[model samples]
Structures are given as C-alpha cells and as structure tokens.
Target: MITVKVPLQEAERAKQELMRQGYFLSGYSVQKEGDHLYFPVKERFDSPYAFEERALEARPEQPQGLRETLKGKLPADVLGRLKTAYDQVGDIAILEIDDKFKGYDATIGKALLDTNPKLRTVLAKATGHEGAYRTQHMRLLAGEDKRVAVHKENGVSLIVDVEAVYFSARLSTERKRIMERVQPGERVLVMFSGCGPYTCTLAKNTEAEEVVGVEINPRGHELAEENSKLNELTNVKNYKGDVREIVPELGEFDRILMPLPRSAETFLDVALGASHQGTIIHFYSFLHEDDYAQADTWIQGVCDRAGRRFELLGSVKCGQQAPRVFRWCTDVKIL
Candidate 1:
C-alpha cells in the first residue's frame, strides 16, 4: 500500500488536506513512527510529503450514515427533504422532521437506528419550545420510550430531561469557550441555566471561586442540582425561581452569563443588578445576520438606563436558528 509520510507536526493538516481532496484512504489506521506519521493512501499524489510503500493494518469498516442507509429506501424527493443532522444526547437522537413527512417518520427513525447502533432511542420534535420553562414536547419514534439522558461534555456529566427541560447539546462548544475564558477565583453566574450545562462545565474545568446558576423552571433546577452532584462538583450552587426575584439576593458577580437567546433582553436588568464594575457579561440573542448589531444596541440601551458604562469586548455567532438568522453572544465589560 502507498502511504504519505509526514512529520508529526504536520500530520493533522496533511491528513485533512488529503481527505478534502478525496485521496485519504479510510478503514485503515494511520501508522505512527518515531517523530513521523504515515497516512495510508490509494495512490501517489502531488504533495509536500513523501509517498512511500508500506503494509498497513486494516480496521473495521465504518457504518453507513442515515442518508446512505435511507438511499433507495425512500424516494429522492423525500430523502432530499430529510436532514442528516440530528441532535444526539448520549444514547438518544432528536430529529427535526418536516410536517410534510409525518407519515414516514417511523421509517426514517428506523433507518437512523439501523445506521447508528449506539443510539438507544430516537425522538421527533412534537412542538416548539413553549410556556414559561421553554420546554418542548418530543414524540418517541424509535427505541426505548424514555426522555432522560446523561450527557457528558467539558469533563462534566449532565442529567437532562428532554421533555421537561430546555437543553441543547449543540451548545457544548460554546460552553467550553466560556469555561476556558473563566479566570481563577472569579465568581460566575449563569442565568436561565438549564441542567447546569454552563455552571457545571465552569465548575469542573475552571478554578472559579464559585459558580452559581438561577433557573426558573422547577424541573431544570432539580436536574441542575442533580447534575452538579453527578459531576462531583462542590463549587456550584443552583437556585430555582424567577431571575427578577432571585438575582437581587445573590449579590454581585465577577461574570454573568445570559444564555436565553429569545427574550433574554427582557431580563437584562436582572443580570445587570448582579454585575459589578469590571464584571464581564455574556449576553445571548437570536437575530438575523443583517440585524446582529441590534444585540449591541440592546445592551447599550440597557446600560444607559442603568447608568452603567460598558465596553463591548466581542461578538460571536454561536449557532444558526434559521436561514440567515443566528444565536449570537455579545460579550461586554462593565465600566
């Protein structure tokens, strides 16, 4: 077999480039030699790395994905409407199927299960997030009939009840980003913290003096406490109540996180009440790409009304909620 010999420092970049060009051979493990790595390939190609002949070990073939498994099983028009992307929470897969394909949901769910053997259950979104808790209903389409899942991220385990709580596994990277930004011994507050994903992640991964979470939803708060215990974190505390009523009692914090993208602006005063001078606030909002700057304006308006000076640190597009609309995070520092 032909192999691409690359230095350990350049292995990742070389491998990615080769894979992008459809030259990297799959089903075989990359061989590592002292100070160097060899990537198995089908044929010699023009590259900076030297191509050499070597016998490589073959690994088990990867399983087919939902799209591949459903090919020929469903009509092309229907298959095209099926999005391969699904939110995976531990052993559960949460799918978003269009209402037009309601009749074929079971077939699609079964195909997903066949493709991903590790998934223990599959659910379809039954309704949009609603009520005071922002929790949504889920219809079990395959596997076990359970809504609870134990999700692990950023060295912390979270007990999430999909039907009773609002939790997004998609925010794992954003949670990690906030965790990495936390300074040692700083007190952090997470508003609308569901299942303690942010609070527990910071507690487990950062040396923060204390990480506090306030959740309005009773079920979310209960799970938040359970998750803190599940992760064996002692520096975390959770309070169940409206932020407007609970935040004033918690005093000031060095950092405050507002993760409620929708209507988070309505609670800006509560978050501001818990922030002191030099405090950093991460505010989340959903807005069209063209109007993203509106988030900054909202923060500015709130600060003006509070008679507080603030400086915009940065803004990031965390995830897309719709076409050209995104979940955005705007970071600011109170002056």
Candidate 2:
C-alpha cells in the first residue's frame, strides 16, 4: 500500500472528492501528522499531493459495526450505552450519547467523523426536546465548535441554530408530502414552522401566493426569516408570536399545517379560525399503534364543536418515535 500526503486542512475535502471519484480505500483510516495528513491509495494520480511508495504501517481494518469498534478502542466499562442513529444536517451530525460515555465522547465523535467524511461537527443531545421553544440541549462532542446548520431540502436552503430551534431531516419526506398537496396561488399557513423548512420549501417549489409561517420562538422566527432570504423565497411571511394569536389575525388560509405533534390537538381551534370551508389542514400527532382512532376522534371532535363537517382526505404514518409510538399526519378538509 502507498500513502499520499495532503495538507492537513485540505485533507477532508480531498478525501471526500477522492471517495466520490472511487479512489479512497474503504477500510483504511486517515493518518495525520502535525501539518499534513496521509491517506492510503491504490495508485498515484495527478492530484496535488506528495506520494511515496512506502510500506504501510499495520493497523486493524475498519469494522462494519460502530459500537464494536468503539468498544475495542475504549475502556469496556466506560461505554454504558450507545446510540448508533443520528441526523445529519449539512456538515453537522446530531444525536444523543449516554452520560457514561462522557469521557469517551471525543473518541466516539472521531469515529463518526472518520466514517462520514462530509461531516465537520458532531453534537451530542444532552436533553430531550423541552420548554416552550421545543429546543433540545446539546453539547459539542467533536470537530468544529459551531451550532449553526445549513441544510438543503428539495432545493431550498434552511439555516437554523440546532440548539435554539427544532429541525429534523427525518421529516424531509413529510415536508415533501405536504408540499405536493399545495396548489398554486393558494395561501398557506404553517404553524410552528421551525427555521422555515416547510414554508421555504413550499414557496420555492410550489406557486403558493402567500406562505405565512407562525412561530412562537423568537429565535426560530428570526432564522425562518433568514432562511427565506437565503432560499430567495419572496412569498414566505414569518410571524413571531403564538399561533393562537397570529392565526386569527391572518384571516382564512387555503391550507393550514399544524406540525406540533405532541400538542397539535390543543391548537386545532386556532387552526380552524384560520380555515374556511374546503380548506385543507395537515395535522401531525403522535399516537400509539393500538389507538389508531384517537387522532381521528380528536380531530373530528374539534371540528364538530366548531360546527364544521370534516372530510378525512388521508392518514399515514410520517415517522416512528418508539416501538409503538408513531408520528402520524392526517389531511382533512373542513366543510
């Protein structure tokens, strides 16, 4: 095996480009010196790197299992638990690590970054999504020390502070699903629109005349406004206030999106106020598998109390949170 020495700062970018062109060794880890980084390559190319036909130092081949590799590298008792799943927003990787893995966070983070060269930072979630802002506490485990994430979805750019607001790449499909249902020249309202993912995507992809995103968190609203400009979306309007107060003032909308899964049921009345007859409402909620009827019942009950007939357009599982708990979205028309 031969090694190629690349500038330390350019190593990651060169590695990614090399991998994309099918030149990087799959099972080898990058070796670094103070000012230069070395990579194992099959043969020398015309790239800007110093190459030498030196015998490679012996090292263990990269393992397929992340946890197994970490266990082999760290003290056995330090890794009490491991979470292998994470959400990547642009160059940032977000996930939770057990408290027992505190001292080993850098090791785990290095492994994560080594495996995914495109990632520049890793944030370990310290607490659940709590408080009125629906924000999660996070700590920088490795790589760059920045929290701002620039995520692109369906050709729209979303700039958000992960710790200040809620952003989920898992909901990319759900966002697209909702965006497809919107028609041109229609006014849309997205309640609890975090960082303008839904609003910007809709405004950029669809011809919605006006897309108003109502968010209670001031920071989220600020980012949403920034994202709208970043994506060059002129139709997006961000309101920084409670949905209950903002929705009523916006009058009626052709389509309304309630994305707060845990507490969307409580805000149905306000959503109704912003809806006219034949208005489409996309309601998201978390429900157990056995009680499938709970979401429909609650939505229907809300419509009935408001003297409006509800037409169930569709119901589908958006994503799963646990074994039995699932995030479900229902599309309904108010008549």
Candidate 3:
C-alpha cells in the first residue's frame, strides 16, 4: 500500500513527472485528502526533486481502457501500427481500426471491454464522414448491437446515432469556450449543430433568451430536439435542413456560431444575412500553421465587399487536425 503524496497544488506536476519517468500508474485517478494529494504508483521509486513517497492503503489498480493494456499484450510491430485514439459515447467505444488490423477487431474489442468495465460495446468505423449528413458507417465488433449513444458534454446530454449523424467528443472544449462567452438574454444561432451539443450547452449553461440550431441531417436534428427536452432547455429551437435555407428565415441573432471548419467559409454570405450591426461571429476553420491569417483575411474580404466592417476580437488554435494543420477559431464582431 504505497503512494506518492504531495500538496494538492503540486499533485498534478508530481504525477506528470512520475509519468514522464515511467513510474506512474495509469489506471487510478488522482485522489485528494484535505490538503494532500495521492497518486498511485506501480512500486516504490526514488522521488524526483520535490516529491516524497510513503506507504498508504493499497488501492487495487484499475485497468485503463484499450490503449494502455494493449501495449504490454500485443506484439510491438502490431501495437505500433494500431491507432491509440478512439471516442467513447455512453457505454460504447468508437474506433477506427486500420485495414491491416481488421482481422483482430474482435480481440481488440474484447480487450477494450475487459479493461474498461463501463463500456458495453465497441464499434469499428468503416468509412470516413461523407454527404451532407456528415456520417460514417460502423460495424459492431463486440457486445451490444445498438449504434445509439447518449453522450454528456458541459452539463448537457446529447443522444446521437453514430451512423446517422456526425459528432465529436474532441470538440467539447471548444463548445464550452463558446458557451462561456454568451451573455444573458442574447439570441444565438449555431449552424451545423450536430446533436445539439453547442445549442443545448449554451441554453443550459447561459442565460441566453433563445438558442436556435440548424442542421442538415434529419437524424441529427431529431436527436437535437430530443436533447433539448432531455436537458430541460426551453430556450433551444432546432430546425431541420441546410443552414443556407434556415439562416434566411431566422432573422438576426446577437451571436452566430459556424462550427463547420472546412466549409464554413462557403456559407459566410448566408451567415452575414443573419447578423446585425454588432453581431459576434465565431468562425471555425482548418489551416496550416503558416496560413494562420487565412481565415481572418477571408472573413475580412467578404465583410468589406458587403459594405460591413468587422472588428477582429481574437483567434485561437482549437485543436490539431493533423500533423501541421490545426482547427482554428476566429472570433469577430460585425460592425
């Protein structure tokens, strides 16, 4: 029953240091007691710089999900080729298995279930997102046969069909960032709001008077409506169909959210139609590191041509899309 104890504030730094030195246990979450923090370790080791180790009640190490367990079980060559990244929704784990590893899908799925007792199903992604719905196919590798999953984000629950609509758990941070900026009684519009994550998060977390979300995918729209009720958000209004068609009818909004990074630019004209003199717009895009200014420039050009001036509020790298490419968000105010 040995553990590494540190002041609560230094716990994170200590755990990170232990992890860097390959002495930290991956399964147990950091535990806090009064002003002290405890981190589980495999065995006693020399304490780095400012850390101390002491014997404490031994908590059984819980096996973390697939990735960590596979490292010691699988051959180095096979393990190196496998994708360690996956998405978990409710009790399901969604994965993108490479073609070469197709034969081992069942084995991997079982391992995932074994390591993570909470997960009841594992679905292998069969294709990339396509069409207006932005959905892909999934094959059940193990456990339950259902594709429907209820995911929670930023205090709101969203029900989604993995094969019928597109959603990303990776965007949770971005959703929270945008939601935190909304002011009381402000009217907000979320374009391409798959499963209503952004819309519901705003409605539930902020005092916005109304949050309207437009989706092209019927399935996603239906789930969005369900999510609104699930979260008991009376301010959310979901519309089915293309944003281009829906934006024209919704009048002007105090803030507009364009989450479709790759194609958000193409819909700027329609988005502008739903804006007033001081509408705040959150525009998302994917750009290489060197082309960081491209999204802002494009928005400026469009605004200038339409006789509307815009103030660049700020820009940030939301997430990494690939090696050098990143998902960027540019916040601007139309004036």
What TM-score does structure 1 among the candidates reach? 0.84
- RMSD for each model, in Å, please? 6.5, 10.2, 6.1
Clashing pairs in 3: none
In candidate 2, the residue pairs with backbone N, CA or C atoms under 3 Å apart (3 or more residues apart, or in different chains) clash, namely none
Question: Candidate 2: misplaced stretches above 4 Å?
Answer: 1-65, 68-71, 75-80
- By lDDT, the best candidate is 1
Cα-based TM-score, every candidate? 0.84, 0.80, 0.84
**Model 3: per-residue Cα lDDT at residue 56:** 54
lDDT score at residue 232, model 3, on the 0-100 scale: 91
Clashing pairs for predicted structure model 1, backbone only: none
Worst 10 residues of 2 by lDDT: 13-22
lDDT of 1 by residue, 1-335 (tens): 99999878545445544643457787888899999999988798656568888888999956435776788989999998787667878778888888888888888889888876767999999999999899899998888999998876656778889889999877776887898899999999999998899999999999999999999999999999999888899999999998899889999999999999999999898888898899999999999999999988998899999899899999998888999999999999999
CA displacement after TM-score superposition, residue 300 of candidate 3 (Å): 1.0
Q: Which stretches of candidate 1 lie over 4 Å from their true place?
A: 1-63
Put down candidate 2 lDDT per residue, 1-335, tens digits, no spaces.
Answer: 77788776556545644653446665666677789888888777756468865455666766433454577777666554567567777798886788876887888888778778778998899999999899888998899998897876666778878888998876876887888889889999999998899999899999899999999999999999999888888898999998877788888999999999999999999988888998999999998988767878988888789888889988888778889989999889998
- Could you give me the TM-score of model 3 versus the true structure? 0.84
Ten-residue segment with the worst summed lDDT in candidate 3?
46-55
